[model samples]
Target: MTHVPIRVGIGGWTYEPWRGSFYPPKWPIKRELEYASRHVSAIEVNGTFYSSFKPATFAAWRETTPDGFVFALKASRYCVTRKVLAEAGESIARFVGQGIVELGDKLGPLLWQFAATRRFDPDDIAAFLQLLPRTHEGIALRHAVHVRHDSFLVPEFVALCRAAGVAIVYAASADYPAIGDVSGDFAYVRLEDAREDEPAGYAPAALDRWADAARTLAAGGTPDTFPCVAPGRAPAVPRDTFVFMINGAKVRAPHAAMALIERLGAEPQR
Candidate 1:
């Protein structure tokens, strides 16, 4: 049995509610990342979406997390929220060069999230995808796109992502459409429908479903439960997978992530 790595995590660590709930009542706020990173295998850095960080800041982040813990950066809004994505070359260049290399081996994929109004234009998207650099400061870079518009739910859009070797973010949201099509070498998922009443964010049955889906993704198989624009699933080559708990009942995000990690046969940080 080939078991590829499946990292279950949540969005950024900082939240006023988490100060007392997820974190210890008397714990230092500065060490929140350290605590959160230990519990979850990866984190989607929402802060990077709005602003760039210095090399020293990224280095300090790398120092806080343990080895094998990954950090997925949200690509700057300057790169994706625009009338013409092809013209985002300069913004992409600036975003990529913003001292992200300091994260070194801890760096993961860059998530380029599109606005709900951003429609699918094959030529424009393909051009934008072409602008993404393969490497930055000698380290390899991977990219994922989260498109919210219903226009993107087409086979042509999936083919564009496949041709570009960029992953399509499988987001579970009430307002946004979820695509199960796999285009890149890895699978990235955002689970956004967590509940406040459930201790694990998701109920036991729902978590079980997600766990199974994640295992399938790790094996390079797309979940049949999610709507797919493409006809079939990706090849069954073992690959790394990232699943993040986001939005909904935000306070239970960490607990949901840890629960998923445990379901995947991995022990969460105590």
Candidate 2:
């Protein structure tokens, strides 16, 4: 079992003015990334949706980060388009073969994010998931599926990932519907923007709730696989989870992640 502390990372983009209230006024992409990297163990790149990454970009990222730092790249829109699996099979294969494989060791999991409008079609989804390449020796990477709609948050939907050997994302948000389903061992949990006005920053209460849930899952091995979506506050590495924080205004991921590292680090060694 790996004892690495929870791996946390900020969401890809932090440049949004976001209602005119964020630091630096002008978020420098590279700088923000470097800062987050210094504190968190991994980051999820949400930029691959609109633009194709040049090999140089991946190489530059590798050059910029430390050895253990990991990157979870979102599969481009082109790869997860609404087209049928058969239609997009070649594109998927090509993207993985050309794009992700090129990332070398920095690559973590390839995230397959389904748009809100993209409803789950059992037949289509099953076929699409089946088309994804399985484990490879070159990189011990797997695919993580994130659904941005209410319909895909059910047991059946989670089961799809389990059957496919993929991880399903657990997102935390004020606007989204409740998360009642616990799908796979490797799950993804995200703690979105809370607020600085209110009791912001992964409140101790929230952490306790999550920690309790995590312990339950850990003990029973219920959600056998665990990846995480987060405010960079959730634990991942040592516990087999992944955390991504999309909320940067009220709570900086570095601050929250460092706090979490200290807390987890202080726990009695087991």
Candidate 3:
């Protein structure tokens, strides 16, 4: 079996609730990213979704994390929430040009999340996907689209992503449409819907189930665990998997992420 890389992490490391529990008590706020980096292989930067960050900030982030730690950035809403997808090229370029290259090899996929109101338009989506640069600052870039509307679950959309080599995010949530289509070379999953009452967000059995699903994904097979709207399964080609424990019980995300990492038999970046 091919040894596919599996990364498990939470949305962001700056949550106040994690200060005392996940982070050490009285730990310097400046060192939060450093602390979190020691426990997880990757982190999804949610702040970038709201605003663009400076190159120095990106450099600082890369410096704080240990080697091999990946940072998956949530693309700015300004780039994806526009009325005309074709007009978003400049905004997309601005977002990408704003120091993302500073992260260097630590940069993982860029997640382009669309609002629930954004319906599927083949031409519009195709144009937006085409605008995504294959490389940024001389480094290859990986793109993932997180579509919320059910209209995006069609086979045509899947084909578009496959052609563009953009991953279709496997979002697991009751409120959002979960599409388990594998359209790109890798798989990106957002495990949302965790329960606050559950200490680890997901029960042990559920974690085990997710681990099995991750293994299946690594082997290039789509797990039947979620609702797949696309026409067929992903080809059995070894691929990397990014599993993020987000939303739901936000406070438990770290624990859940760590549990998933353990289940995958992968070591944290410490």
* Per-residue accuracy of model 2 over 1-270 as CA lDDT, tens digit each: 224334566566355532123235555655665555655677788887667777777887877776667788888788776566546787776667655655677777788877767776777888888888874546666787777766765566666666777766666666654343444445455667545544335676655555554454444333323333221222232235566666635345444544444444422112
Ranking by lDDT: 1, 3, 2
Worst 10-residue lDDT window for candidate 1 reads: 1-10
- What TM-score fits each model? 0.97, 0.75, 0.97
lDDT of 1 by residue, 216-264 (tens): 8887677779788888767789888999999999999999998898889
The local distance difference test score of each candidate is: 0.90, 0.60, 0.90
User: What are the per-residue Cα lDDT tens digits for candidate 3 across 107-189?
Assistant: 99999999999999999999999999999879889999999998987889998999999999998898989888898898999
Weakest ten-residue segment in model 2 by summed lDDT: 229-238
Candidate 2 clashes: the total is 17
Kindly report which residue stretches of model 2 are placed more than 4 angstroms away from their true locations once superposed: 1-5, 13-32, 83-86, 135-137, 178-185, 198-200, 211-239, 248-251, 266-270
